[model samples]
Every structure is written in structure tokens, then in C-alpha cells.
Target: MKFATTLSLLLLLSSILVCTMSTPLSRRHSLSVIRKLNREGPFVGLITVYAPEENAFLASNAFKPDPRHPFVDLSGRRFRIGKVRGKGVVYVRCGVGLRNAVAATQQMLDLFNVSGVIHFGIAGSLENSLRTGYVSIPKQFAQTGLWEWLKANGTVGPEYFAHLDIGSYNVPEGEGINQLGHIGYSAEEFYSESGVPNVPRRVVWANVSQNWYNIATKLEGMELERCLNSTVCLPQVPKVVIGQRGSTANIFVDNSAYRDFLSKTLGVSLAEMESASVIMTSVANGFPVIVIRGLSDAAGGQDGPNSARALGPLAALNTAKVVIRFIELLPSHKKYQDLK
Candidate 1:
């Protein structure tokens, strides 16, 4: 009886050990298997848009949603994986804010084998030369919404609202005024060494990937649509331009004074809501990013509020066309494989 009891205990212990070995923990012990299952590779393109109009344009042009294609629903956000110009691509409508843009971009990085990102949408023209329907590929992106308070003594104080600085009046000498209150306020002129309250100006800037910039520079003069339907049209034919700075924020700017400020202060050629966020996120992930914006309105230039409504569709369509052309020109996967 004593021998039989000892044998039964040993058998039970052996069964437990066998069960543990077949579980997930044991399967994870092999490094090769873990890598093979988790590691994602090969380049998949990521295209992001912010508004419904932009989404409609992309869906009709490059990304025709197919029910057969795999669709991923994560955390109440939907991502459609499709083919664009014969290349595997994913389309995401990130909504109209910095938070949404960043979150969606990060999700793409986590779930897909993304090679690069391209942002396409409409923007208000900051540069006088960029008229309605003109497309611009910005080289640098900045946040216009960020503001630092300036004390009477010419020193940095605290943060303040950016819109408070917009207007067409001079900051009176000691009237508790904002320097950017007026158009033609030059940072270089105000912040000289001999100027009052000597402090370095604060501005954060993010640059596009050099490889992507090179590709954009070569895309100039590409055909763009300038007509709004059969009857409506721009005053002049629009063309693609490259290598300019753009600003992004949540603000929908319709004030010409602020528009001039952005152009003069930051050399911003275009102003929009989502590109800067996407660019920064791409930079953090060490992937190439490009922003192609079509001029939808003048941002309160002489065109008035109806300008965007009248021209927005044309701008979105032209921007989409440029993006499609860029994708067609991207280096083939074989080139990347050779490097590996």
C-alpha cells in the first residue's frame, strides 16, 4: 500500500508538468517562433485624411473600399486596408484635431507594416502666390497655436491664447499689448540684441524626411485641377509647388490679420489643422512623411467665407491626384529587398 501511494503522487506531478509545457508560456520560450509571429515587415503605405470631403475624394480616386478586403475595427476606430496603384495601403480618417491624428497614426504603426506616411487635405492659403486649387508640398511644419506671453519689460512671461495676438493694430508702448497684435510684426526686428527685454524667441519646428522632400521637389509642375465643376473655375490655372513651410492647429482661421502674421512670422505658405501632428508623429517613429495641401480658401483674404465651400472639393481632388502620382513614383519593393 505504501508503494502504491508514492507512485500515484509521482504520476500526478508528472501530469502537471506536461500541461504547463504545452501552455502559452512554454510556446514563448522559442525566440524564433516569437519573432516569426510578431515581426511585421515589407512596406505598406499609410494615407491619412481629416474631413469627410477629403475622405470622399480619396475613396473615389485611389482607395476604393472593397468588402473582400480585411477591415480592422480597434477601440471604436475603423481602418480599411486596400490597394492603391497596385501597392498595399491603409486608409484612415483621423477626424479633425491633433489628438485624433496622433492616435490614428500610432495605431497604424502598431498594427500594420507601414513603410511611410502621406497626409493629403485642404488648407487656407497663407502665401499670396498660392491661390485656390494650387497644391503645395510643405518642407517644414510648425504649430501656430503655441504662444508665450511677453511681459512689458520684453521678457517671456507665461502662455496665452494665440488668437488674442491677431488683429491689425500696433501693440501700444506699454498698454499691456501683444506684439503679434498687428500684421508686419517681425520677430527679427523685435528680438535683436539691443532690443528691450532680451530673450530668445520660442518656436518649435519639425522638418519632413529628406528622402521624401527630394521626391516632392521632383513633383513640381504636375497637372492639377483648377475648375470647380463645369461652370465655376479659378481665375488662373493652378500648378503644383514644392518646398514651403506650413502651420497647423485646431483653429479654423478666417482672420486675414492672423493669416498675414503666420506668413510673415513663420514663413508659412499654408495653414491647416492636421498636418503638423502627423509630421511630428512620423518623425518620432522614424518614418518618411509628406504633406500635400491644396489651397481651399484664402483664410479670410478678399475671397470671403464662401470661398472654402465653393473651392474645397477642387482642392481636395487635386491634392488626391498628386498623392496618387507620388505613390506611383515610389521606389519598388525590390529596391528595399536589395538593400536588405
Candidate 2:
């Protein structure tokens, strides 16, 4: 009797999901459903990369018992609130780096189908103004089409609503912001153990170089499309920034060339394992992108200190709070309804 009743309820919810996702959905309708009861609040996605042994993700309290579905395999897992500000708002822990970030973003889109994605995590500020505790919301990103996609429709993707500056940058006053170019995306195994020839900091430099090359190619493609369309702005060149990033791989950090390049050519702020991937995924999907990093370790130098590990979580939490506030300040859809 009890088993039958539970099964019935599961079947009902499954039917609902199927119906909701059946049509060639509209972005506004998607947002309406996502923010339905919670329309009074902001509809957002909070994603986190769960670094090994970090266990920082478990700190969130948004986990709610979700009815398990074969299509959605979060079986035994519960939805935890990575962080919540108010209505239509929720956060998810999407493991670490490109793969994890992409998967998490996809899941959030498929499940809740929110209007915006606010990736709140820590990055190593390669530059100075983006200090140990400071947060960064880089406007533009560089990526490879092989691993991901970049938005070219000029309009928001079919699944999202806002097409607000998807690719651009506004480096905080003084952080070598002028020197910025295109943000880079690197996957695991991006560099080798032994530094490359002519490049003692092979690991760091390789990741940075590869990321820039990949992004340049992607941007060139977008520029080509714009020219064909004959838009007013024939080409849009993104200002890229070199920053410190946190990286996680089997190999140890042993290259100095990355630092040399950073000091000499790029003055980057931080480096981490997953940021490039995150930026690529967000931009491709037409979602607003922000790379927030907590200083973990200084690359190519003596293993600085374990302090970054402790400080990273706090930094991520701070970033989360700021994102929520920013959403609050954005002009609500109500303001655009009649005007649009």
C-alpha cells in the first residue's frame, strides 16, 4: 500500500517534468516557471566546484529532498542550498573545473531553467589589485570550440532570457586592467611535469599560452560571423586579462616560466584549475560570467602556504553574498515589460 502510493507520486512528478520540457520552450516562460512562486525574488543559479578534500560544499543548507528520476540521476543525493538569498534563488555544487562546471551548469538549466547563472567560487588572483581576499567578475573569457561553444546569435540562447554583455571586461581600477586581453580556459593535463624548453615555468606558461590561443581563435570566428552579417560593429574584440588561477591535477606545480611571463608580459592576477573552463561554458550558453577566486597557492614558487585552502571558502562565501546583492540591484523584469 505505502510502496504503491510512493510510486504513484513519483510517476506524477515525472509526468509534470515531461510536460514542462516538451515544447520548444521560450526563455520568458522558462524564467516564469523557475521564478513562479518565487517571482518576488531573483531567479539565479549558484554553482560551486567541489575541490578534493575541500568539503566546503557540504557547508550549504539548501539541500532539499528531490524526487528521484531515471533521467535525473541525483538518486540518493539531496539538493543542498549552496547559498540562497530569496525567491527564485538557489545554488548548486557542481564539482570542480571545466567538466564539473559544465555538467553542473547543464543540470541547473535542465532542472530549474533559471534566467541567470552566478558562478561563485574562488580563483587565484594572478595580479595584485585582485588580492588574496578580493573577488573578481571578469567580463570576457577565452576558450576553444573543441571543448565548448561561444554565443554568436547576437541574441540570448533559446534557453535563457538576458543577452546582457555576454563577453566583455571592466578590470577594477589599477590592477593592470589596461593590459588585459582575453581570459583563458585550461583543462586538466593542460601542462607537463617538466618545464618546456625556453620556458622554465612550462606548466603555467603552457596553460596561459594555450588558453589565449584558443580564445583568439574562437573570437576570430565570432568576428567573421559579425562581418558576414554586416552589423554596425563589424568585429568585437574582447579585452583579455592574465590572472592567477587555482589548478588541480596529479602533477605538482614546478614551473617558473608562467611567473616569468606573468611578471614580464602578462601581470596576471590568479590561476586555478577550473576558471577557464567555467568562463567558456558560461559564455557559450549566453549566461553572465564571473570568476571569483580565493588565493590558494602561488604558482611556480615554493609551495607558499596552506593558508589559501582555509581562506578560499571564506572568499567564496563572500563572493556569493555580493552576487546576490547585485541581482537585487538589477532592474527587474517589471521595469522592462512595458518598455520592451
Candidate 3:
């Protein structure tokens, strides 16, 4: 009886061990384990915000998924690993919003040995010269959404936070791209860095990698799709415009008054929800970044002027094409120069 009982206990213990080994860990635990092992990366990171935006990368043999581990699931985000244009890449969907962008980009950086980051997405044109389907690779990015929300009286705020009049504003009905504004938007205040304490840093513009910017400039004359389908075409042929300015915030801007204010006051050519945060995160992590944006609308409150819903996909595809080409131009050596 004793022998039989001991054998039964041993079998039960073995079964429990097998079950524990077979069961997957919680997402957080999985992330911790991956972070500890750190085996997944060292590839260029391709980040997209919307599904349609990533679909472009997907459609080109869908980026030819990485044979080893095609997808890595982290909580809700699924990062796709693959090769695009013959260069290794880890693509991830960055959900909309400033926080989401920061989280996704940081996660990608943390999870991989990201040589550099290339972000492609759609934006609303603050410049009339940039039409739908036109791609703009901004020279730098500003996080304009970090406003002081000053009182109606505009009394007390940070000295650097420019006071924006919330009321009526205007610009020429239709005009070319205006120059960048001299006004000060709020700069991010960091209290400490590199183990130094009691030091504050104010960073306003996050510049793009000079190398990437130069490569993007070469694509100025590249052809882009101007139509979603046969019957639906843009007003003009699509082309690339390099070296403009873009800004990001949590706000979804549709008001012409606000749009013109941002354009004339800040010289913002393209406005979107994610670029600044992505750039900031990359900068913090010592990674080089390049942003490619396609103009989907004019950010005008008027019905016909705001065609983002219709043109978003077309714009996304145009930017994705530019991203792929940009990738082709990247040095095969992963140790690309980072932004200073």
C-alpha cells in the first residue's frame, strides 16, 4: 500500500510540473522574461498608427514575415517582425494619442535592438501648397499639444509657454507653405538626466536624423499614388516635399481658425497626433528617427476641405512607399548615426 501511494504522489507531482511548464505566463511576466533574455532584435523599427497605414507595408508581400518569430504579442500590441525592401524590420502599430505613441515606441525600443526608427503616417496639411497625397518629411517635430491652458485673462503661466488667443484668427484663404513661427510653444521640462539631479532641460524641437533627412530629400520627385481608385483621384499629381515642420498633440484639429493660427503663428506645415512623441521617445533612447507623413486634408472646418476620411488611406500608402524607399537607402550596417 505504501509503495502504491508513493508512486501515485510522484505521478501527480510530475503532472503538475508539466502543466506549469506548458502554461503561458502573464503578459507582464512574459515581457519581463523577454527583457531579461533580450534575444529579439537589432533591426530597424517601422511604426504605424492606423491599420490602413500599416496595410501598405503588409501588401508588399506583406513585408515577408520573419521566419523565426513573425509576431510577438505584448499585452494588446502585436509587433510584426519581417524584412522590407531587403532590410530587416520590426513593425508595430502605435495607437493614436500622445501617450499611446510614447508607450508603443518605447516598448519597441525596449524589446529590440532598434538601429533606428522610421515612422510613417497621415497628417492634416497646415500648408495649402501641400495637397492630399503629397508626402512631407519634416525637418523636425514639435510637441505643440503641451499648452498651459491659460485662463481667459492669460495671467500666470510658464515664461516660455506662449499665450495663444483662443478667439478668432485668420490667414490668407489659400496660400503656399508659410515659414516656421518664432513663437515659443511649451518646451518639455525634464528635472534630471544621466544621473544628474537638479538640472532642468527644455527641449522644443526634436530634429530628424540628418542622414535620413538627406536621403528623404532625394525622393522629392518620386511618383506617388493620387487616387484611391479609378473614379477617385486627387486634385493634383502627388510628389514628395522634404524639409518642412510638423507638430503633434492629443487634439484632433478640424477648425480652420485654429488651423490657420497654427500655420501662420507656428509655421506648422503638417499637424498630427503622434510624431513629436515618437521623436522624443527615440531621442531619449539614443535612437535615430525619421518621420514620413502624407497630407490627407487641409484641417479646414469646411466639409469639402476636410477630406481625411476619404483620403487617409491614399495618403498612408504614399508615405509607406516613401518609407520603403528610405529603407532601401539605409546603410546595411545597423550602426547608423543617431541624432545629436
Candidate 4:
């Protein structure tokens, strides 16, 4: 009886161990683990917000999916945007913020067996030089609870983080293709009015120039200044800048506390509704992501001729071009093209 009882206990213990091992650490993290299980090579996933305005931007060009591309579900969940060969990168529009971003990212990881993820979307500028039409890559990301949480759960730790070993995709000396980036926060507010001047350390930031034009024009007299400003399309752009961009969930332009939060925490030049969620989720998932935003409004200003709704698509189009440029220069894609 003792032997039989002992044997039964051992079997039960073994079953429990198996179950524990099978269970994922967090509900949100299962996608990464599943991705690890189905390893192939060189496939990258792109995430964007799924808004009607954003779709309008994408409508200008319908990027096709690669039949051989593993993640092209055709269910609209995942679509392919042509094959760059050896590098089978795909573009997908996941909804906005943390919850949507997390779901979209995981879906990409699980569905396509992609090797990495890249994010292309609009971000308000946080630097002066980064006008409405310019673009910025975030070198170091900043935020509140989001960053802290990602450090605890992601490949990049609390001190600072990045998933890929990104090097310059150099075009030439004083030339076209460059590895530009910046340090900015994905925050939850817009327009810092705490009376504390929100200033950013000298870090290069990227943002689309046209969007900057939209907002800067709202600043009392900026409307006329834009026509005379050529920096709007400067020849040599920096990796980043602090523009007139700040963001918030609610568009309460009268809130003093919210503005202070933007100044103190985000150091925002322009205000928008997304970025923080994207950075948090991307970092957590261990995906090598890039943020490309177009300035649709100047910091602490009203909407000009183009509202967020109108400007989103144009920004997406410009950003898409940049994404394509990066893909073209990728080593895998280059080699694949050479064979052809």
C-alpha cells in the first residue's frame, strides 16, 4: 500500500510540473514564446494604428502581400506588402495604444513567424528643427509606468533598452540615407501648462515636416511664418528634434495639470494620442521597432487647415516610403536582389 501510494503521488507531481511548464508567464507574453517556437529566418513585422484616417493614407498605395510570406492571413488581420526577397518583411496596421498594440504585435509574432517587428506611424515632434514634414527615429525611449513595466518583462532592462543592434544604413557622406534617431517619451498628455517650461536635452528627434506646419500655423502668428520658412524641407535633416508636438487622451485644451504633465514627463513639442503605447508594447515584446511620426500640429496649438483626421494618411504615405528605403538597403534584401 505504501509503494502504490508513493507511485500515485509521483505521477501527480509529474503532471503538475508539465502543466506549469506549459503555462505562459503572462497572458500578454505568449506571442513572444510562440514566436520562439516557430523560428525561420529574416521575416520582419510592421505595426501601425488602424484608424480610418490612417487607412486613407495607405489607400494611396496598396502594398501587396507575398504569397510565400508566412503571415499573410488575407483576413485583413495580416497583409503582405510585396516581397523584398530573402527579407520577407510585412506591414500590418494594429489599432492604437497599449491594448491594441499588444494584440497586433502578438498576432504578427504568432501568425507570421517574423524574426523582428518595425513600427511606422505618426509621432508629434518634440524638437524645434523637426517641422511638420520631417521624420524622427527614437534612439532612447522615455515614459512612466510603461517603461518600468517593460524593463521588468522585456529584453531591454530598466536602465535603457533596444531590441536590435541598429547601425547606420548610411547613404553617403552628407547624404540621403542616414541612421537618424532621438530620445523622447510616449506620454499620456499634451500641452504642458504647469508654468514649468518643458525643455528637452539636446537629443536628435525625427518628425514629419508637414504635420509640424499644421500645428505651428495655429500658434497665433505661425500661419504666416510657415510660408517663409524653408526649414520645413531642410536639405540636411537631423536624427531628431523637439518640435511643437504634445499629446493627450482627452482634447481638453484648458487643463493646466495635464499640460504640466506633458512638460515634466514627456518634454513634448507637439501633442498627439499614441507613441507611448507603441514603445511600451514593442519593447516588451522584444521587437526591434522604429517610430516615424509626422507633425500634424505645433505644440500647444489648435488644428490648422488639416486636422488629425486629414493629416494621418499623408504622414503614413511619407513614412511608408522611408520604410521601403530601409528595407531596400537591408543586407538580406540586397543579396536576394543580386541573385535576381
Candidate 5:
């Protein structure tokens, strides 16, 4: 849900709270970057996680640049200020991992008069049916990295993923699953920021904007890339499946057992490292956002070697295709016009 302006202001008071100190680092950073750039727009933020993904987006024919100043620099980062499908867009590579994603996205929003955000990149498929090269525009994203290390005297959470939900993920914590030594995955808690005063909020899923989801849904059944090259092809044709819940974690998932745990517990179709942060930040600021992920591997369950080694570039290219199409279709939408 988008945070209300009144509630957003109230959150500043948290700096004086006893549970924590100071405002969220993103808020402070936002003020500084906005003051510095001081730009205007209804510009949509296009963010990607690393070079391969960014490069693919750049190569798209849809990335039409503003001839006068197609590129700009901010604090050593290069951002492409352009148009996608005739909609104003500012694209940047938000390096890998959760923290990097949060920082880079916040900077982009701060530097431009951004109306919304679109983040896309490669992912490891958590669902076996979602083969390598398939693109997933998940309706919701969850940060799976947040957890509580339950020890021998453990109790089920009011704070974390339930004991029943995370039981399979528990390692041999010096004893059996009944003991507190296991790790319990948890929902990330948002205090005061949830917009209701004095309430510490927790969520099982963070959502993307429905309007964006409506636009993205049109891409379903659109053709996807199925081959890395003539000979190196995926088992079958790639597809764009929308609305499945996806997940993210700072850790790269390469083990099948861990992947199964996430899929069963979270109903995740795809898993990656950065999009959850982007969605959370955008939601906090009341901007529409969406994440598109292409499966590069099967989260360690692929028949052969992890497909990402040879499949990353190909998967990224497919996501770029979907994103570009989405942007092209975005122009003149009732929702975006409201932003202007």
C-alpha cells in the first residue's frame, strides 16, 4: 500500500523513538540527492541489477534517448535519461544485492521527478514449471533474507516465519527441529512507517502497483526467447507468466533443497536478489513499481550445470523485451496521466 503524506511525515518523529535512532537512511539520502539534482519529470525509473541486465536494456530499440543530454552523472553513477516507447524514462544499473539495490533505486528517485519505477533482471526459477528463459512478472515480492536464529529454547514467532513454515529450512541447530537451534525466517517489521501511529507492522508480501500489473498482464502469451544460440537452446519455448508471487534474498540460491523450502513456504515462482528492495522503497514513497525477472537457472535443480552460466544474457534479453513492450503500451494510460 502507498504511504499517505500525513503518515509519511509522522514517520520522521521516529528519529526520537526509543526502539531505534534517527530517520531511515533512505529518507536522509533522498533529501540530499533531490536538493542536488533538482530536476523535473513524470519520468519512470528503469532499474536493473548488474551489467548484463543493464546492457540488455540498453541494446533494446525501445530505449530512445534525449538527443541533447542522453546521459547524466550523479555521484559517479551514469544514468540514461531517455524515452521508452515515448514515455520519459531514466535508466540506471543498481548494482547487485539488497543493500545496493535499495541505495541505487533511492538515488534514482531522489535525483529525478520520478513518477514510478520498473525493475527487471535475471533470476533462478523456484518453480520447476517455470523453465530457464521464462519471464515472470510477479504480483508481490517478499524479502526472504530476513530471519530469526531460533535457539534451543525457541518459541514460534509473533515476529518471524512460523515454526511450521520454516521448519524445512532449519539446519541441524545442535539438535532436532524441535529445538531452538534452527533458523526461523521472518517477515520484515516496519514500525511507524506502516502509517498507523505506534504500530509495528509486519507483512507476508509486499505488492506492486495494480495499474502497472494491468499493463504488464498484456505481455502474457507474448513471445519469449528460447535459445542462447542456434545450438544452445532451452528445453522448450520461453514464456511470460504474470501474477505469480516472487521472492528475493541477498544470498544467491544454488541449492535445490533451499529452493524447495522457499517455493513451498512462500508460493514463490521466481527468486532473485534485488527487486523486493525496489518494490518496498517505491511502495514507501507512494510510487507505482513492478519487477520483471527472467529465469536463468532452476535454482540448482536444472538437469545439467547451473544454466545461468550460459543463460544469463539470454534471459536478460527476454526481460528487456517484456519491459520495452510494457513501456510502449504505457503511454496515455489513465493512471500515468494522473502522475503528470
Candidate 6:
């Protein structure tokens, strides 16, 4: 009787172990099934917004959340997978700044097979030519935090810089400071070292996809809001303009002198916190990306403090309208049939 009881206990323990191992397998299978379902329908386009104000505009005016499709990623990032004018889209409000933009973009690419990405939001005008509520599409996007080391002195520059490696596609070597070199001075030997810093740094420029650029040109005459409200209004009617360079950095620029410098040095029409990172990530991943920005504030000078508050809503609305039109212009799902 004692031997029989011991054998029964051993059998029960073996059954428990098997069940434990199978539990994880079952969970994995369930996750796989969920991901498969998400990808089964059609190629989805991604639209990202960095702020709640912009998100509010998008939710109300542009894309509608599909009750049938709600998704939250492993990182707890919630997404509204839905349709805009019958096109599949995923809308994510990635919080402000470069890190948030990059992380959210990477997560989306990992989770979904997105056909393209479009980022639209408010930006400060770097050039006087642009004013609040004017929508501008970037011909090229660049990051602007790099500094050049002054070889004459050990000090790093006031010289802003950015670099792109050779052989990258769709990257234009823009006019200012475009050269190939190492990060810091490197010499074959101590004797070969130039007394000055020989460190190679190229000004990096990431261009919008040519196909998207062509599409933007077609939107040239679209009307934009010039008024803050019926009571307060812009001096002139605003219009959508295409093909200007834009720069991005974490810094909220409020100085007039620095704004002028950026305009001249980078040929930048608008400055913002997130677009360059989004463009860079999309380019590296071989995904097409476009950025449409509405000028909310003139970077410093007279129109600085109240510009974003006064013009932000109008700017966001203008950008959303353009994004909607762009979505409409996208070719049928048949073009993306093979993507599935």
C-alpha cells in the first residue's frame, strides 16, 4: 500500500510539470494569434502627434477610432487603430521630445507593418517669411544639436553641426558645412595629426521621400486658417506652402538671434521638437515619411510668448486638413495588396 501511494504522488507531480510548461506555450500562441489578426486586414498608415492639443484636433476632425480595433502594445502605449476616409490608419499620441518620438516610432514599426508615416503638428517659425497658421511641408529634415570642436582652442563650437554617413539615400548634402570626416581628429600616427581638429563632421540632411514631395506639390493651393477666432484674426489669409527645410531639437527656442542663425545656417523655415527624429527613424527603417508643420509661433522677437496659445488651435486644424487631403490622395489598397 505504501509503494502504491508513492507512485500516485509522483504521477501527479509529473502532470503538474507538463501543465506548467504548456501554459507559456499557450500564452505565446495567443499573442501570435492577436498579432496575426492585427496584420490580416490591410496595410495601415501611421500618424503620430506629440501633444494632447494636437491629438484633440486629430480625434475630432481627422481619424475616428474604430470600436472593432483597439490595441495596446507591451509597453502600455495605447493606439487607436481605425479608418480615415476608408483608409486604414493607426493614431498614436507620442509624448513630446526626441526620445519619446523615437521609442514610439520604433514600437509601431515593430508591431505593425505600416506602409508610411505622416507627422503633423505645430512648430515655431524660424523665418520671418512664415507666420502663424501657415502650413509648411519640409523638403528636408535635420537635427541641430551637434557642435564642432575648435582645433585652435580645445573648446567646442558655437558651431552647430549634424552628420550623415556616406551612401545614405535621399539625404541631400545641404549648403552649410557639408563634409565627410570623423567625429574627432584621427591621425594614422602622432606625427601625421593636424594641429587643428581634423575630426570630420558632415551636416546631415534627411530629405522627404520624392513620392511624397510630389504629392505635397499638388496641395499647394489649399487654404489655411489665418484667424485665431472670429474676434481675433491674422492680418492676412494663410496658405499652405511646400518645400522648405525644417530642423528639430529638444530645445524650445525663444531667442531672436538664435532663430536668425538657424534660418541662415540651416536654411530652416520651421523649428520643432520631434519631426527630425521621426524622419530619421523612418528613413533608416526604409519607411516613407512626411512632415507637415503649422507655424504656431515666431521663434522669439515680438510674437513669441502668446503665439502658441493664440495660434496653436488654428495651426493644428490647418495641418489636420492637409493630412486628411493627403490621406485621400493615397492610392487604393490594391497598391498595398502585396504588402499583406
Best by lDDT: 5
What would the per-residue lDDT of candidate 4 be over residues 228-333, giving only the tens digit for each residue? 1332332333232323333423232223333345544456544444554454444444444445455543343333443344444444555555555455444553
Candidate 1 lDDT tens digits, 48-152: 555645554555567655445345555556666666787666667778877888888877766566777887888899878887789899888777655543333
Query: What is the lDDT for 248 in model 6?
Result: 81
Query: For model 6, how does the per-residue alpha-carbon lDDT over 234-258 read when each residue is reduced to its tens digit?
Result: 7778889888998787888777766
- Model 3, 292-316: lDDT tens per residue? 9998888884466578888888888
Clashes in model 5: which pairs?
Answer: 150-180, 151-180, 151-181, 152-180, 160-186, 161-185, 161-186
* Model 4, runs deviating above 4 Å: 1-40, 51-62, 68-76, 79-86, 126-129, 144-261, 270-274, 303-306, 333-340
Per-residue lDDT of candidate 2, residues 209-319 (tens digit): 332223223221111111112332212321222234433332223345444343343344455555556554444444444443434334554345533555555555444
Question: TM-score of each candidate?
Answer: 0.73, 0.47, 0.82, 0.50, 0.81, 0.73
Listing every candidate in turn, what is its Cα RMSD in Å to the true structure after a full C-alpha superposition? 9.9, 19.3, 8.2, 16.5, 8.7, 11.1
Estimate the overall C-alpha local distance difference test score of candidate 1: 0.69
- Candidate 5's C-alpha runs over 4 A off are 1-40, 163-180, 191-194, 197-200, 333-340
**Worst 10 contiguous positions by lDDT, candidate 6:** 185-194
Q: Per-model C-alpha lDDT, please?
A: 0.69, 0.42, 0.78, 0.45, 0.79, 0.69
The candidate that wins on TM-score is 3
Q: Is candidate 4 or candidate 5 better by TM-score?
A: 5
User: Residue 89: error of model 2 in Å?
Assistant: 1.5
Clashing pairs in 1: none
Candidate 3 segments whose C-alpha is farther than 4 A from its true place: 1-41, 156-158, 168-185, 190-198, 301-305, 334-340
TM-score of 2: 0.47
